[model samples]
Target: MSSSTVKTIQDTLKAWKSLVFPTFKVNDLLYFFLKAGLAVSTFALVSLFFYLSLSHPSFNSSSGYDYKTFKHLVQQRTIADASAGAEPTNVSHILFGIGGSAQTWNTRRHYTELWWKPNVTRGYVWLESEPPEKENWPETSLPYKVSANTSSFKYTCWYGSRSAIRIARIVKESFELGLDNVRWFVMGDDDTVFFTDNLVTVLAKYDHNQMYYIGGNSESVEQNVIHSYTMAYGGGGFAISYPLAAELVKILDGCIDRYSHFYGSDQRIQGCISEIGVQVTEEPGFHQVDIRGSPYGLLAGHPVAPLVSLHHLDYVEPIFPNMTREDSVKKLVITYKTDPGRILQQSYCYDLRRNWSVSVSWGYSVQLYPSLMTAKKLETAFRTFQTWRTWSNDPFTFNTRPMSENPCERPLVFFLDRVESVDGGETRGSYVRYVDVSQKECDREEYVPALAVQYVNVSASHFLSDLWKKAPRRQCCEVINGGDGVDSAVYVKIRSCQASESLTPP
Candidate 1:
């Protein structure tokens, strides 16, 4: 063989040996660095997670939150703590304390089924005329059935002139029959429309054992001002706990004589209630929609609170302004018959102004957006809200809409799993796999579109409730940025894991 060929082959073999196997020392040193890099990455992720949990609870996945990595933190508190108001103990609840005029049966008959008949589960309709001895009233819409039987109350006060003051007698008469068996006594005029679902919810907030005179104020400042702000307007209806009802019955007779000069039954009742030292604890749902103009104004700004009753609806302006009262009524039936909740929310949710301010501590506020991502008790830069307030004095109002979709409604902070996509105008991201953040089970691992300054109101009362049944989604608004940094997003716990079944009424 040629010497030149052999020399080249020898050199190639020597070079290939070094390439095939590096010295152990060199390889081990290189391996150490690779392992160190991996360890550092793991440490950083752990620390990031820890920081999110402790210091800043809410986080935007911008620092690296993705749908797969985002996990919803388990709630620390139980559902019972969140729903302290609506806990249904062993008490049997009652439905009504209806007060109708004896002289107006013919005129009132049409409205009887419209309001009280369909909604009331159990209670009496106290009428001026002989209470229907027959278990059923003449047929009405949907043929509303009476859970509570009707009974007439006898009174000496003549009709027309003394009709407004008759509630006093009605109260005494109702007291005469013993209401100690029931927990709540709901009072309303025959024409008043009551949303019993909301009424019950509002009542649940307070202890039945405590004297709760729950209701709302009148539209007229003069009326509220003339009477003490403590009085709940009658048209909107009012709730009295068993204890309060028992107590009020005792003083109502004596107080009625003193307030008899008042123009209407409502004021007289208010006077009696107030005299008993049981002032009206306001629940915005009991609206006094007594204005002469369009109901749209009143309906548009309906409170975020549950609706107890809409009084004088028969006497109020057209529900749909510009239409005849009859036409408005027809439209209202059509509008609300299918989904009353949506209709009510539509009436109230739209046309809200940002006159109110809410604080968000942890969520990222995009460029030029209002602050977003507040928890139930987030201490925002504004030292914002203690528990989701609408204005300075109002926790909720028709004029204000809260961000509902963000899971930060609870005081717990949340972190974003990651930004899945950013479209410049809007950012698509996934929050941690939370128990109640996603409204739909389908959307749990999905990417959600988010933007800054756009406050969105989720109608859900709480996140956990959204899972089993339809919850009230808050009004739609914008999300701002986290106060801390661009990488940060609000990490929050939506609600306790406890489901609604836990609070089932006894």
Candidate 2:
């Protein structure tokens, strides 16, 4: 036709190409749909992961990989405020594995209320047989029995005692029951008394979703060698995290059956857990008090680590210098009930329930409460006191002359009494160095001649006696390693000396 007609056709073609050109090439409609689909899939997957994280209180391996986010999530999971009427951060239960026959409940039942009830509210007593609930059911209403059968373990406990054999099953059954709400399952013997609050605090530090076998080793070198150090000593008790507990419940029976060569429950359980590549996370709180000497020094001076449990309370001697076995048990239990934290934090200082005053600022000093005993007189009184007292390890301390000056400059008492007097004859450094409770590394202090007392300052028998009546807010110690040599001793000044609180023994 004409040039105008050709121009009109070209314009129409350009307009058509602008609208539909891309649609004709490379399946543009399909590509657009595919991009939309990929975006929706990515968003859905992210949402699913977030939803899973919210649903699970603890973390999994994938969640653990997100370091910062996972840490924040963990903080939220375990922050418990009992001050706000909330329970402990780690919701835990104690499966008190007692291997008693029908009669063991007679005396053992009493300890349940005194020790276990206050701390482990969610504890259960696992007995070989059900306790008699009626006329002669001892004196307790604790209904913690789970199972009594010897065949509870899939394997026959070839070398195990009745107690040793059933441990596997006891743990399994307890985990099954506690699977829902309990974040941790703590296994303890009936005599095991736990500082449950500390236990909760300790568990809060770890992620519940990760497997943890946490406990203390035995004090016995022989026992530790015979059994692997990886094993948790049974008396002190141990804790398994929720995720680990779930995993163990699934395969522990099988593992136990395989490890029939093991003699004890602790060894058997350790073997099974080790298969899952979990190492024993040692926490010092679970004490298997195998040491025979008084745990007074240990209990009074726990070095600020959380005091979780003390085993064999009945078996140990009196913690105080002079007290009946029965009275000592009562006293310790009472002290723990009063303030477990204070006991651990102030593990360094203790009382004799008598008339002398001693304190440690950075260094230890002695002050005779009735009179300011000179170094000679102080030694005489302490020596005379030692004659009657069963414990004589800690001796009175004095500066070069006497405690005639203010006792505060050198608080007059120390938990670690001097093993030897600095000088039998009075001189410049006439003093004694006791086992310093503050020095955790050494058995005894290096040396001393008394220093300026700063932190602790108490005076008079009556005042000192009543000082700890109301629990102190925290443990107070000079935190000095006392000695003559610089590296050897913690240099502390004496503030004051005080006597024990005069509370009547219940």
Best by TM-score: 2
Tens digits of per-residue lDDT, candidate 1, 393-442, equal 22222233433454423222222222322233222333332233344322
Candidate 2, residues 71-146: lDDT per residue as tens digits? 5534433431111234535434334444344556566655555665534366567776656654554434355564
> Which portions of model 2 miss their true places by more than 4 Å?
1-101, 118-120, 134-141, 152-159, 296-301, 346-506
Scored by CA lDDT, what does every candidate get? Answer: 0.46, 0.50
What C-alpha lDDT, on a 0 to 100 scale, does residue 329 get in candidate 2?
Answer: 55
List candidate 1 stretches off by more than 4 Å.
1-92, 117-120, 131-136, 139-160, 179-181, 321-343, 346-474, 477-506
Quickly count the clashes in candidate 2: 38
RMSD of each: 29.2, 15.4
State every prediction's TM-score relative to the real structure: 0.48, 0.55
